[model samples]
Target: MTDQLTQVIAQATLKDGMRNSTDSLDAATHSAKKLARKLFEGLDEDKGGVLTRDEFEPYFKNPADAAEAFKVFDKDGNGDIDRKEMRNAVSRIYRERRALATSLKDMSSAVSKLDGVLLGLALLITIFIWLFIFNPKGTTAQLVPMATIILGFSFVFGNAAKNLFESMLFIFSIHPYDVRDLIFIDDSPMFVLEFGLFSTTFQRCDGQVIVAPNSVLFGKKYILNVRRSGPMWEATKVMVSFDTPLDVLHEFRTRLRQFVTDHPREWKGGLDVNIDFMQNQNLIQLSLIPSLVVAMEHKSNWQDWGARWDRRTLLMKEMKRIMDQLNMTYKLPTQPVSFMSGQNKSPKPANSLLGAR
Candidate 1:
């Protein structure tokens, strides 16, 4: 079977004249299938019509042809062949031949590629011969030192160059995020300070600078928070004792929201402020931590980041003052643990819980 398959492939090579042809991998695979089918049709010893592994072993010498032949005839691809499938395989072979015969573009494309290959080879040989005859060894080396340098550089920095270029293209073309636009890269919130040719500069809240190579940034995805329709939202949160009246908390939140909404332009319009109850603010176990959420619009310097910071600082201060004015209970961190000593200690409803701590 192996020798017969080899002879069939050899006959196909001669019949199709692929030895001097510019056939693609698909074309070569098709040719192999044709050759296998041609050989299979002639095998009739101990065969029940369909070509199984046992029946196919008599004709398919090459493993590749055998595999391809099985795939061609296995129409339903259940890994076996039937009489109907074997018959249909003949039609497929005929159709493939007819299609190839009628495909002028395929023929032209093959011829054009063949011409190009031949011309390129001829030119390369001509240049090599001329260089050998007329050009000195030193002259050849000197002329191509630049090409060598470029090749050497590519070997060293090709990936970096590709990444940097892609990053630059992304920065300028896609505009993923711009300067002053808040973004998170690698879980760190950063303000984009500058976008450079090969790196990006970011400024953290502590005045520390972060210099990331463009390649590093390009390699990882980022969380981009930008505004198109309106000013970006800034969320603030503060925790307070549960002793604070719910009505007072609600009033404070309502006042803040109304203040921002009434003068929309001052807060950059469409001020959507929210204050909600939260579980213990800290992740560690604490129940009814009674947290206050704040989202308010403010008018301030977007460029300097002072507006948001100033507004946040002032709002925190005012909220603290309001809580104090209302005489709602709160505690200082350094307050002595006199209650622990039971010295002049009495049961105070507000101070009985961990909120005091």
Candidate 2:
């Protein structure tokens, strides 16, 4: 009888274990379905029932999660998930409980910092108001000292308040375009650092910082690479040897024009090439002007494209190809001759190039 009872107990234990395993599997399946539904619901809101990368990305915490989700959702061998397939897939059961906890912790820290700043500002304002209301009155000897003290404090506080208010206004009034919108100013290229209420600060590509007032930026005539809303303007000037043949010069212009035409994506629109002769010192100067317009908005890094090594390399290669085609000996000058100064100091009649020479 004892042996019979032992066998029955073992059977019962096995049955309970099987039941637990089945329950765990059911729970896991349910959790996965819930997660998948959440992901699909987010995507389905925009479309009738579709999933795109942009729509699905916000649900993923990291690249690995995204890859895994994509693998599960991609029912076909196409390597991407479509709306219908994504809705059909079972979601994973793992909850992002840790991520939610971390986010809440960070939010608390930010709120604490903001509160401290507000308290400090409030205290400073209270002190200023107290001093203004409790002015001291006495004999001329004591009155003069009191007046001086009040004046000194007033001057310091007034300037500080003015600066603070102006900064607040500037932050609230930021617009699409303002003074800090150009690649070059006064013909000198620089990197814009920040735009403030009263002044603008910029660092040159070579690491020199320049500070100019807002008024100065508004007043200046500078070349701007305005994105999408306008055309991208680029000017290239080449000075060829005086002895270069006219055929060589014409070939150079043609090659430059062709290069611009070939690179449709890089050079968006038409090309303008101007060839002119002038007198430089006692020698003849041949100028090849190529102005190409690229859609400023299309270039990925319009603001910093010039500083990119790859862009510079591409530009240099194109320039070298043109130079080789023309068989021209040329000098790339650091500065271009200013037409205003050149015209103003002309020694001969305005219409005649020979007379000027």
Candidate 3:
């Protein structure tokens, strides 16, 4: 079966011009495998995995080749092919073809670009040889000094060029963010608007655009991609006086949960409310982490941001209503001040040498 399959694949490769007549056995075999998988799946009628000799005949000009292909595909000596057998036979073939195509495309691109450079190098080499053969002493004297200057110049500026090279690497390889993606750089949220080879343009929420080099972005502490993250909790902190009862805090949590439940579209199903901290026996800081539903269907991050902003306003308003219902008062910090009864009297001097004088 192996020998017959190899023969059929070789014949197909030759016919398709995928393998030249003078090609080595290994080269022909490798090329034959890529083209065979493309033909392997096309003959299946009724979208079924099995391919009888009749179904394979139209793909091949000769009936003998079709019969041979059926025997190779039909494992376990079963008259029909099943999905398992098809998977085992064609999966590796498809992978090899895809990999070979990608490698060839990359190689062709690299070689095409270098072709011009190589031609120019060849011309320069020919001229150099002619000059050396005719006037070796003078040519050597001139070339040595020219090469030294070029080396020194490169050494002086190579560090500066490294930044540009790193920028290219960041843009092409790391790919930290894409256009329209909402990312936080240095804790400031910005929307990516454009991507250049060496720099990226970002738009702040306040409508300011920043063009930062890729190298600079790569050096930041961290870049947070909001678009790639899950729904985030919107926190609202409130200070309540120590006199407030525990029952009131419990009621606030319950009401906040109910609000999230009622507005299912704007908020997620769950929430958290807790006493985050307490001041010096004065007030308790209550923290609410209300999970805001991410607007994934929006056209852009800006639209999503706007939608979240409105939802936050609604949440705050609902919170205010709940607080008003429970008669909850905010505990604002106070400062003590003293006023003198006699405004016209002179101020007292400090208790120092100046006061004694």
Model 2 score (lDDT): 0.50
The positional error of residue 349 in candidate 2, measured at the CA in angstroms, is 34
Q: Model 1: per-residue lDDT, tens digit, 1-357?
A: 346445434433343445335553345446555655654566545555556655555456777777776676664444566555554454444433433333333335434644675698699779777877787685577658757887998989888758756765665566555554556666666776656555667888678899877666664766554322234545555556545666766666655555454533225433332445544432211111212112121112233244455555655666567657666454433443424336656645544566757
After TM-score superposition, the amount by which residue 114's alpha carbon in candidate 1 deviates from its true location, in angstroms, is 35
| Structural similarity to truth (TM-score) of each candidate | 0.39, 0.41, 0.55
lDDT of 1: 0.52
Which residue pairs in candidate 1 collide?
A: 2-61
Model 1: lDDT of residue 207: 83
Give stretches of model 1 more than 4 Å off.
1-154, 177-194, 203-209, 221-229, 261-265, 268-303, 331-357
Q: Looking at model 2, which ten-residue stretch has the lowest summed lDDT? A: 91-100
Backbone clash pairs for candidate 3 read: none
lDDT-superior candidate, 2 or 3: 3
What clash count goes with each model?
Answer: 1, 0, 0
TM-score of model 1 (CA atoms): 0.39
lDDT of each: 0.52, 0.50, 0.66
Per-residue alpha-carbon lDDT of model 2 for 1-357, expressed as tens digits? 224323323332232345236664466445445545665665665665555455555667887776665655553334545444543343211212222233344335434644576799899778756665675232434657767997998888886556545543443343223323446666676645455455556777688888875444543445443332343445556666666777776776677678766754345435555555565632344443433333222233344344334444565588787777667675543343333346567454344544576
